[model samples]
Target: MTTPRIVSLVPSLTEAVAHSLPGALVGATDWCTHPASLDVERIGGTKNPKVERIVALAPDLVVANEEENREPDLDALRAAGLDVLVTEVRTLPQAVAELDRVLTACGLTTRPRWLDEAEAAWDAVPAPERRRTAVVPIWRRPWMVLGRDTFAGDLLSRLGYDHVHAGHPERYPRVPLDELRAAAPDVVVLPDEPYRFSAEDGPDAFPGLPCAPVSGRHLTWYGPSLAEAPAVLTTALRAALD
Candidate 1:
């Protein structure tokens, strides 16, 4: 069987497909930065990919995420008669399952080893003795946080960090800085993407609370990064408390 040529709009999905099938990827978004040596036709960013360029590539399959991609762009691709595989992963289980489905669609006959390792890594995480309440800020200025049903929120919950805005109606809600502080969470969890929250920048905002500056990829991206996220995030979270 001929290997399917793939174009991945999501960075995590790009990494997953790249690892599973080395030569399978023919096009990927500029944001798909994993596998550092990955050389493929660079489409635009996730939110605004050049639809025409993707169609011109004539890939066998195009992988995208519901959250990372725009519906209109996907519609355009489908209109061009391309096979598109859209994945929605809001939890670890969903991620695990979606990875399998994606690789299979890319023409893999068996589950990749990295996927197995990622599942085992999450499974090995022991239940926390006590849960810590946190406010996870994705961006500042307007102050958007991880609210109800977010992948990051679900991942943090597994790590024993209960999101304060988990009950909010919006997935990513804009809250005033005053309200955020008033929530009085045990800690302020900060990931360094979609915003780049650093030790010097993010921690100063919440004067009295511990600020855990963690890797954005580990906190959010659902790919090979999941295997080390538990240990990496735990160390960052614990360092803030210590």
Candidate 2:
């Protein structure tokens, strides 16, 4: 019997599910840092996963994300006669749906109970005192934050966070440092990738701010693994607040 060969086009899925699926994941991006078992390939990324390289892998399935992978790339893969599975996870519930979707695609009929346990984890966080949080997705020459209409912002709302910066719109909106300081959020977090903000890289953008570093996907993926975020981010938040 031939083992199922797989290729992961997004780091988040690679870390969260691909390795756990008991299939041969021959390739993944540089960012697929978990399991540390299939750390063999550094294929492109969500928007730019190397098609030719993935083709070379001759995977039975390719896992990606609608938001993470570019449409043209997905189009070309389909045109080349590949059955690409794209997951679009917005809120936490969608995340659970995606796990089921991916499991079915892999020709696997079983799912672990941990999936439900994961979903319930986020429910445990005491509702935000007020939905007043400022989310900065990237911070560089020009600081950028998520605005009101984006999926990231919407998740903040569901979790009872106000996402103070969503009023800016434009998904990843660039703002002045002074404006971030003015936002005066109860918590300010930096994602680990796209911008790689650390407690070291800092909340200098918001002085005297309760800032902390967190895994971007842990807080943002909104998938079957959301139950893990609050505990992880809260542990980080505890350190920052303490």
Candidate 3:
């Protein structure tokens, strides 16, 4: 079985999938910084993939996602007759599908037993009993939040938590703190990235509501890593609900 010489064109799954596929990855975008120890070659970012630089790496397959990456690069890569595996993940199921596709494209089907363990963990994660959650994704000017139709919201819905702004049609909506108060989230989860929600940030408008820091990667990036996120998220959700 020959492993394909792979290059990851997206940053979100770069570091993680690189480690999972073993020798399949030959290059990745400059932002692929997860397995921090591996010295994979750099291609570029979502907008600027440095096509010339990527071509130089001579990858047998290039993996990319639809979120942050642009379409033109995909077109150019396809036009050049490169073997590209593009995955568009919008939901948790889609995230799992993306990982499965990557592994299939890399020509490795027999995944480690840990993958089953991870899937079991997700399956075992008790569904949220009563919908209740105040998921605050960011801490910044205008105060952004995950709303209906966003990946975070989809996950929140799965956990049985009533996402504070899931009613809004927009994805990440910038609203006044007052608006959040009106929504009144029972559990306010501040994620660790993009906005870096912190306990030191102090009590928000809510007095008795449970406020805690959460993992941005688990909530945001749905992939191989997410297989383990159920335990973490379940623990957090239980803590918040309890």
Candidate 4:
């Protein structure tokens, strides 16, 4: 049986598929930057993928995430008669299961070592003695934060942090900075993507709170990065508090 040619619109999925089924990826979005040595056709950004170009690539399948991609773009891909596999991952367990499903769809019969390692890494994490309240801001200009049912919120919960806005209806809600400051979170968790919240940039926003500036990829992405996220994130969060 011939291996299916794939195009990944999700960055994390691109890395997962690339690591699991080398050379199977024919195209990927510009933001798919893991495995820095990856050589494939650059499609476009996640939200604005070039449908016509993807169809031109004639991939056997195109993988996308419900959160990272827009509905109309997916509909357009389907309209073009292309087989598109859409994945929705909102938690750690879902991420693992989806990775397996995606790898299987890509014709991988055996589970990749990275996937097993990632699962084991998360499983080995001991539950925190006490949970801290946090507010995770994804963007700055309008000040949007992780709200209800977010993958990042789930990861933070596992690491013993509860998002202040977890009960909010919107997945990403724009809250006024004054209101965020008023929440009086024990710590302000900032990931460096969607917005590049560095030491010099993000900490000043929260006057007295400890700011844990972590890798956005580790906090948000669900791929090989998961294997090391616990240790990396723990270290960053602890450093900020200590």
> Mind giving the per-residue lDDT tens digits that candidate 2 earns over 48-156?
7788887878778888887778889988877777789998865666777887787667665577566767766756768666454654556567777776555555655
Whose TM-score is higher: candidate 1's or candidate 2's? 1
In terms of TM-score, how similar is model 4 to the real structure? 0.98
Q: Which prediction has more favorable lDDT, 2 or 4?
A: 4
Q: How far out, in Å, is residue 101 in model 1? A: 0.6
Which residue segments of model 3 deviate by more than 4 Å? 202-209, 240-242
Instruction: Give stretches of model 2 more than 4 Å off.
Output: 129-131, 149-160, 222-225, 238-242
Q: Which prediction has the highest lDDT against the true structure?
A: 4
Per-residue lDDT of candidate 4, residues 20-127 (tens digit):
998999999999999899999999999999999999999999999999999999999999999999999999999999999999999999999988899899999998
lDDT of every model, 2 decimals: 0.92, 0.69, 0.72, 0.93
Model 3 poorest ten-residue lDDT run = 200-209
Question: What TM-score quantifies how close candidate 3 is to the native fold?
Answer: 0.85
Residue 51's C-alpha lDDT in candidate 4? Answer: 92
Positional deviation of 128 in candidate 1, in angstroms?
A: 0.4
Give the least accurate 10-residue stretch of model 4, judged by summed lDDT.
200-209
Listing every candidate in turn, what is its Cα RMSD in Å to the true structure after a full C-alpha superposition?
Answer: 0.8, 2.6, 2.6, 0.9
lDDT of 2 at 39: 56
